[model samples]
Target: MSLRTLTLSLLLTLLAFGPLSAAIGVPVTPATTESATATEAAALEAAREYTASLKSMTAKERRTLKREQRRAVKDALENHQDASTNTILLVILAVLLPPVAVLVYEGELNNKFWIALLLTLLFYLPGLIYALLVIFGNM
Candidate 1:
């Protein structure tokens, strides 16, 4: 097989296998998951601190605080949520061209893009729904 075909096949195979492997109870140790849980706890603590700090600001301070919060939220969503696409720009693109939204959200021309594009061509609603789901981590 050609390289592209082989790679695509492998990707699809792994995609198909992942949920089944999880359902079948693949063996895994707890050490790696423990570190991940620790990081989540730290992040949760930071969020709590942020919310508490917001409660004591003056009106002008609250306006500045909101702008800062917006910047931080946008940065976090861009880097982690939507694969580094500029948040406002990505939302506009998502509204105008849904498949392109999927491409940007994934940061690659991957399976999700192809699937969204195909669905879009076949029917706009399904494509839009799938793109939204993927973008929002619902699917």
Candidate 2:
């Protein structure tokens, strides 16, 4: 084939496949806000149905159900307790060490350590939002 003809054919091929390549690479975004709202509504409906079912059950049956759920959770925790404990410790160390290091490095032991400890505890509840406000002031 002629050089010009070969170059033109390759350009057209690339142009045709470029969008296909992009489509293949693009990750699928989760459902939009409206779909998320619908999903939450469905979950609420399911919870209401489950609660209504529980109300119809006898006290003995309810107690048995609770016992079974507790047993299952206990068993699962026991099986994975080592890994779970390690993960929890690692996360605590990660979140705590940075602030403590900063406090010690700056030699603000009295004020900074107490504030960092308080912020770290609060972070366990409301998380980064509380930390951000405490450390950096409100955005």
Candidate 3:
């Protein structure tokens, strides 16, 4: 998944779990706003509780979770995969240097990346848009 997609999925997950609310910048549906706020508070409390319990975890479980997270992040950064994995940093990178992002996703400065780079060199807008598409697997 693209970083953009990953970030959005994470945001939605947080929203659904009540870990986010308008107070954080994104607005929730009016019908769910109250629920969201309540959920957010609960989520915070749960997180705090988990933090307190962290030391109680078996070392293997913690290592497994860490490994999984690392693998997911690595896959997201290197592959223009699915399941919506957009991250803020990836979005910023895409915006600031689209060609480089394309190269990273493509794993080389290959044809697609070159095209993106050329477009970027020729015109910023086309380059940026093309890079976004490429990184998101549209290309």
Candidate 4:
């Protein structure tokens, strides 16, 4: 090919890749080592303050606080119990029903919902075990 034709081809190729290379700006260097140490120290100080606050509360005060919190929760739940329960049930049904319906219509019981339900029941066993552990520890 002529020099002009070769030069034009090279220019076109560079032009095509020019925007891509230009888009990749300078690489970002990480924060200085001193700044990282300061950040870690700050986080540790905040956690220590939080733990100190928790440790400052007396057992009786904590129990009374928890009891009041539970009473508030109970009152709120009582006020909206039926509506909340129905809404949760509806959401669960909506999520599980469509796939379940399809499975039943197809005469298949091996769907993900059945598997998930079984797994959830099985997972509750661990929670029961943990409760037993806590109960026996207190005895």
Candidate that scores best on TM-score: 3
Task: Report the poorest 10 consecutive residues by lDDT, candidate 4.
Answer: 127-136
Off by over 4 Å in 1: 1-85
Better of 1 and 3 by TM-score: 3
Sort by lDDT, best first: what order?
1, 3, 2, 4
Alpha carbon lDDT at 85, candidate 2: 51
Off by over 4 Å in 3: 1-86
TM-score of each model, paired residue for residue: 0.37, 0.37, 0.40, 0.28
lDDT of 3 by residue, 1-139 (tens): 9765665576446545653454477855465788889999999999999877777889998888789989999998998645334444454576778888877777776899889989989977788788878766653
Across 1-139, the per-residue lDDT of candidate 2 in tens digits comes to 9754564465456544656758479876878999999999999999999899899999999999999999999998888746445434433333445354335334566665566567656643333233333343421
Q: Write the per-residue lDDT of candidate 4 for residues 2-97, one digit (tens) a residue.
A: 754564465456545655546587576899999999999999999999678768999997788789989999999888746445433433332333
Q: What is the Cα-based TM-score of model 1?
A: 0.37
Backbone collision count in every prediction? Answer: 0, 0, 13, 0
Pick by lDDT: which candidate is best? 1
| Worst ten in a row by lDDT for model 2 | 124-133
What would the per-residue lDDT of candidate 1 be over residues 51-139, giving only the tens digit for each residue?
78778777889899889989999998887754344644654565557799989878899999999899878966677668767887843
**Candidate 1: lDDT of 76?**
84
